[model samples]
Target: MPDAPPSAAPVEESTEDWRRRNVGRLLNEAVRRFESRVLERLAEQGFHGVRLAHVGVTRNLDVAGTRPTELAYRASMTKQAMGELIGQCVDLGLVRREPDPADGRAKIVRFTDQGLHFLEHFRRAVVAAQGEMGENLGEERVRALLETLWDYVHPDGT
Candidate 1:
């Protein structure tokens, strides 16, 4: 293969230049775009207006079937807000609250069979959306980038 001319070479960026460029802001914009794309695709797949926050709660429920208080802590949400959201999910038949064995005072929120089915559909939509993005950058690079961001976001452990 023939080497490219020097005039076409990649630009060398100084640390100071990169710092002044607001890279974090840029990354935040990229994330927003990614999220918008995913939501659009989900709608196209018949899940209109299904906010990503709902998926977060489902993901949390899957990992830890906990009381509302514990879920709020894990999800970094205010208890009142979590309760409201969980109530909405319950109304939608996306989740259920069962009496907590450890603490009868609190009910553990869990995914119902319907919620599990919806979660699976959500997973497929997310996977397809990510795969579409990965077509441009490759899946490995996207995965590594996400992992690196997670490391910074949850430095203490999530």
Candidate 2:
């Protein structure tokens, strides 16, 4: 009979250390890496200065123009932050601020033609990046992984 391979030594870790480094922490790190990879891919596809967060505004604008307050609520960002980002977008000619019909004092943010074009490009980039990732993980595993992750994030439908 062949001899069994030498047994590996058990590495001991403290309960506090293990708890301190749990799945939530690991998942957060993984998400950062995943977003970085996706954003890098997006830049290669002509979205030079865009990041993942831009998706929220672009999509929201595509659906319908919204006030800064509404966008902040939807995106879970501060109104000031949304305003600043909208200002930067306006400077880039991606979006515009137009007078709100209901409230003359309020301006709604709308996506420009260029912004729509960029949104389409962003969708394609995301698809391409996800395709690459799915290829690495395989379709079946990717589907299962997505389902598991979704379940973890939201017990019911989200």
Task: Give the count of colliding residue pairs in each prediction.
Answer: 0, 0
Error of 1 at 60 (Å): 1.6
Query: What's the TM for model 1?
Result: 0.73
| Per-model TM against the reference | 0.73, 0.77
Candidate 2 vs. true structure, TM-score: 0.77
Candidate 2 lDDT (Cα, whole model)?
0.75
The parts of candidate 1 lying over 4 Å away from their true place are 1-21, 150-158
- Expressed as tens digits, the lDDT of each residue in 1-158 for candidate 2 is 96333223332464344433556665687677666777787678777877666766776664478888888888889989888888888876779999999999999998888888887777776677677768897988778978899998798777
Candidate 1, clashing residue pairs? none
Model 1: per-residue Cα lDDT over 19-73, one tens digit each: 4345565577777877777777767766664677776677678534668887788
To one decimal, what is the Cα RMSD in angstroms of model 1 from the true structure?
Answer: 6.3
